[model samples]
Target: MSLDVGAVSSSKNMGGFDESKEGAEKSGVQEVGDEKQGNVKRNMSDASMYATEDEEEDEEGNKIELGPQYTLKEQLEKDKDDESLRRWKEQLLGSVDISNVGETLEPEVKIISLSILSPDRSDIVLPIPENGKPKGLWFTLKEGCRYSLRFSFQVSNNIVSGLKYTNTVWKTGVKVDSTKEMIGTFSPQQEPYTHEMPEETTPSGFFARGSYSAKSKFLDDDNKCYLEINYTFDIRKDWAAT
Candidate 1:
């Protein structure tokens, strides 16, 4: 048997030609792939730009921009209007009054100290001192002896304007005319104001041997009573028993 060397050489040349053709086809496919990748990149960049532009537009196609000249006062006013509008909407929905929702301003006027003095002009402290008991004016009154009711009080700043105080004496649950109502404006002071009620003008002789009470009411400009204080005292026939 004889081997054909020519046919073998021809087969080797055909194999080389097929290999070169395959390399050329592979090179063309690589160029098409690179072009498609570039097109995809360009499309993605265009999509990103469109998305950025759309973000700046409103529903009506108007561009939105924050004002550079926004002032603090204008911002505060806008916020206040927004709050008012919100409150109005809530009131409409719930049928409630928004003004009376929170705590209102209430004034406080308290009697800090009280004392009685003898005719010799000496300060004599009460038996049950001022503010000693939870409530009441704890003092003893004499029938014939003359004494003075000296008191110091404190007024709080909750009182924007002036207030009127009405002092009244109650004997057996009946209102007696003793002292006139005092009206004055109060200021923040370190020293308290002192008031003296003489025995002649007080309800000493008129009050019998029984339990009596003195009440003071503070009234506002609208005649609304805001604060009230009471002092309960006992009356005796003999001055020695007091």
Candidate 2:
């Protein structure tokens, strides 16, 4: 089933994309207004936040060590005799039906949809192309307009570690902006997770209004890419006449 969480916002920063203002949720709907405005730049830079190799260095060249991981069933069986622990597990895992899962230890994540919300405009649900190719114009952003993006996805089997989002934009082959947000880990569940990004104001000015190429990616701590999209959008002097 599709979910509607309303319009959200995001900002750009000097580092790249601004850090996420809030955490993701397994369920719920949030409506955001379009009043706030500011210069957004890439914010967070904690390389330790993502899943690294058993031994690997972050951007700062610090070594990170990861231990063994447990599958959903294995985690559920833990402390099976502890009633309190069982109850807590039930609350944390929320609606995960182990009987329906297959014999795989690796977690599976499916990105369902991405919706763009703008003030005084209908939400634009961008299609997730199967081949990761440009189907056509993804969407157009009016110069100086306020908007946010909502991502809907599902995880299954084991737990997904360090799920994150990254976006990079370019104009005339010159890199303009890049963003990275840590979406946190998630347990397998029947209900899809919905994450609404922070609000952001599109760049305004004559030079900012033009066609651009962009790539959006969803990955986990293991650096395993789930979705990679190559698409095009426009920063227009005015909203498209459609």
Evaluated with TM-score, which candidate comes out highest? 2
Q: What is the lDDT of residue 214 in candidate 1?
A: 60
lDDT of 1 at 16: 10
Q: Model 1 misses residue 19 by how many Å?
A: 99
Query: How do the residues 85-131 of candidate 1 rate in per-residue lDDT, one tens digit apiece?
Result: 55533332233222332122443556566577657345656543343
Could you tell me every candidate's TM-score relative to the true structure?
0.40, 0.71
TM-score of 1: 0.40
- Quantify all predictions' global Cα lDDT against the true fold: 0.37, 0.63
Q: List the candidate 1 regions with Cα displacement exceeding 4 Å.
A: 1-110, 120-137, 155-161, 198-207, 220-227, 240-242
